[model samples]
Target: MTCFPFLFGKKVSSDVRRDPEIDEGLSGIRIKVYTYKQLKIASDNFSPANKIGEGGFGSVFKGVLKDGKVAAIKVLSTESKQGVKEFLTEINVISEIQHENLVILYGCCVEGDHRILVYNYLENNSLAQTLLAGGHSNLYFDWQTRCRICIGVARGLAFLHEEVQPHIVHRDIKASNILLDKDLTPKISDFGLAKLIPSYMSHVSTRVAGTIGYLAPEYAIRGQLTRKADIYSFGVLLVEIVSGRTNTNTRLPMGDQYILERTWELYERKELVQLVDISLNGGFNAEEACKYLKIALLCTQDTPKHRPTMSSVVKMLTAEMDVNESKITKPGLISDVMDLKIREPKKKIGLETFPSSYNASSSSDSQGTTISLAASSAATTSTFTLKHDQSM
Candidate 1:
């Protein structure tokens, strides 16, 4: 799957040990482990023509089994340099999880040096390809279908965040990771960077790992990852769904490049309707569409405390409840965050750093800060060791 790029970086936890039961329980569940040879034959020796998708870790080939079932075979590159740890994480997390909006993992092939993943073949590929890629050249989603897709993804995320035994935070929630089935139903793929968040703890700070654009500010900058980080990222994805473009656009003029900035600008001007993809051609409900956009903005508020829980988001999107716009505040719009100062700590008497728990829109100029968005709304990541001083 194209969604597998999530594993090619620093986000994955290294401490997840392989459960002895993982191999022993294989006989009880429906998961099958095919030999490398079997998959090779099914994939026609991994021919280029059968290749349906690709990403950072490897290529996905469409295959037909001897029993005549179609499948998607993901073969990890030998050069990927990933070891047994990544393979075990994917298997352990995905095998235990089952939900309709989550991709189905049929099995895996781990023979010697070869590491391969098997999943159901989705005919519609991903939202990135059909909805946001190259301006919708292949397929167009009508308004009703788009609504279903959004609600479907929310339900999936809510399951992972709440229903699972140990709550899981899907560290990476972006357009590409969302695969579409034949009926345009959205299934979230790629659990490579998933982290188990215990019910007792509120947050964990680790080295940031996620796509640059969809990253949440608190998570990206300070490594304070909570479920809110995922909420913030989902807010960005909602923008992409309504507008049919990536969150950041480097090609456009400086002022109009970032989608969040553009959306907020329109929201403030009462021109949020204009933010809808013109390609929709007035087919979507104006009032409902704007409500969706507003909800997305609310999720992306600068303060993590302000974002709604995934359960609340589902109710709002489904029309079970109304979005209270009175609490909406200016979100932390990040554009030029590339100029971060992190990791290589230097001793200082009292380094003036912004609080990790940021709520206000802007800080005083006296404090050198990384959280402030430039006029262009450019985003980059940074971190610091803080020593708060109330004396100032």
Candidate 2:
């Protein structure tokens, strides 16, 4: 299978055949093969002004293709060899996936030391940029929009877990990875950390890599990841989308500092209404909102075996199946596994309804369930890698 180099008809390198990573998926797909120079021109030579997003892997720039198509170009960091691997992995996975709720890949560039992925530029960017990283936005994610996003994300996960050939486990499912289209329809992005599990294997053990707040306890502690790990992440994302806050925010009262624990606390007290974002200003449905919260709790249960599959999750969220509260157990606590530090909120927003550290003990807060937090200032970055070392 001899092919010309990207965008150039000339081919002379004999070593191209020996290197699988050089251009593994290029031969299989008919998508546009971009050259580094082409992308550079599209992105204004990777100018800082065009940069839209930055993360562990690389920086994403907003670019206009020669055909007048607007695209998002992700340029991998040259310093990190792992970034290149992630670039190839993303292409391998997302290239085959064609879903309404998944990001559309225009093409990619793998020339010299440059690695870039071109995607359809989403108008709303990401949920993180607009919602989670809140500061300024005309976008109002009302109750219906939030619900639609949840349902869309669930269907995407369902397709990956059930309908896909070998089944895909999205290790990193968070608000930042969720993009919104012009109509605000949700699309799951970033398959760099995704794991492809053959149907025969029940689970795969490897190094843990995902957002700290969304990490499943079993997966984080033992590196044993199954489809349930994605379920747990989706569960955390559900809570965030509904509450209009991140899973972990330090700028709040100790009791409410950790959203997962606070949401659980509200569930235990049968006061799940408290879990809704105050920003909604009483616009959300009480019954439906509570049901979504409960279903999320079901997904993040302590035992992965107890968690419902993504397909079932979709049916439950879409009101196709009645969620059984009796089946839910203790929710997986991320703070319990990692060193989480809580920061004090400003003095203006006093703790009113929630019991703070002062008098939380004697309060009849749902049968005397204690709310205590141990905080540490420790911080560490997250990354993904295979379990290649059998000796370790």
Candidate 3:
């Protein structure tokens, strides 16, 4: 058996100064401290063949531990200095929480310039790769399975938002981040963009970091984050899970391009049921499906206060509480704030084409103008950064 270091050294890097907060945070956390060599061997020298997923943060690879357990290793791109904060945040957040719907953290590696995260290897990929991306996956997602997945995701969010002390806000809640286990259970992954909200504070002010299509209007514009921001993203994911499509699809007709806009149009016309994916083949409960769509509308309302809490959303989905159509209003659609241009990709992961990731932030410059642009050319994903003029 290969011996590994279980404790972190006095200093992580010789060149970079370690933050006192990170040092204090790491000292108390109960997760295993892995070395660069052990993780490198575990991932077979980070082989390309072991890679299962890719995103702006980095790539995820499937690996086997010395004890014979399977795992997914996430290696942060060395170029992203910002990723170090995310890496530590992920370790600090997930290492303390445990839930069936939340992804499990096996351990992490932080040695020299290398940073990696280890998680239980999920058999099936994410909903974005399978359900919404379509044709690329062989898994069958009938109505019952889809319904269960939606609730499972909602429950996980509710746990984070309500049950956890100093409740957490998952700033990025999109299809690509929702992974599926062999039993088809939904596990919410990626805490890089997560923020913790203490009981006294209503919201936290920070630079915006999340995918474009799923961002809430208030958070995107004002740079103020609350649990409702996550509610908005979850609302979009809810629609995608039910409709089997991405939030933004330029290929569709102009009026039907944005899912939230189309959903609102249908709700007004009493044709909301039409938004359901045709792949269901009349197999789903029409009334329940429509109710789910309505609940989504409630979650995405323009005013943060207008949106229901995740726990209430759970009760609504489970039929424990009534969904008040009287309170449903037009969602805070992404198209209203800025125009998004979708360029044809050189390759595809699923059938539908959409932006892999989007990052925009508020600048602290004297003029209060923010100019940020980031671009990536990964085969399965790409990154697009934008400039922001809004000030909080």
Quote the RMSD, in angstroms, for model 1: 10.9
Lowest summed lDDT across 10 adjacent residues in model 3 is found at 358-367
Candidate 1 Cα errors over 4 Å, as ranges: 1-31, 337-392
lDDT of 1: 0.69
| Clashes within 3 Å, all models in order | 8, 0, 0
Candidate 3 global TM-score: 0.82
lDDT of each: 0.69, 0.71, 0.73
* Model 2 ranges off by over 4 Å: 1-20, 24-31, 336-392
Span of ten consecutive residues with least summed lDDT in model 2: 352-361
lDDT of 3 by residue, 1-392 (tens): 11111122233323333345455556655666667777778889989988776655667788898878898888777776566677788887787578889899888776666777889988887787778755667998998899899899999999999888768898878887788999999999878768888769998877555666777767765567899999999998999989997776655677986788999999999999999999888899999999999999999999999999999999998899999999998998655423322233663222111112111111121111211122222232332233222321
Superposed on all Cα atoms, the candidates' RMSDs to the truth, in angstroms, are 10.9, 12.3, 10.1
Q: How many angstroms is residue 102 displaced in model 3 relative to the true structure, after the best TM-score fit?
A: 0.3
lDDT for each residue of candidate 2 in 1-392, tens digit (9 for 90 to 100): 12213223233222212225656545444456687878999999989998777654557888999999999887766775566566666766777568889988888776766677899888787776666655556788889999999999999999888888667898878777788889989888878778888789998876556555677777765667799999999998999889887776555676886677887899989998988988899999999999999999999999999999999999999999999999988797755422322333331211111111110112221111111122211242232221111110
Question: Can you give the TM-score per candidate against the true fold?
Answer: 0.80, 0.80, 0.82
lDDT of 1 by residue, 1-392 (tens): 11122233323222223334334323233335677888899999999988887555567888887678788887766664432444555666677478889988887775556677788888887776678765634788888888898899999988888787467787777777788888989998877667777778897655565554566777766666789988988898998898887676656676776788888898999999998888888999999999999999999999999999999999999999899999788877665633343443342222222111011112211111312211111243333333211111
* Collision pairs in model 2: none
Residue 354's lDDT within candidate 3 is 18
Candidate 3, after superposition: displacement of residue 305 in Å? 0.7
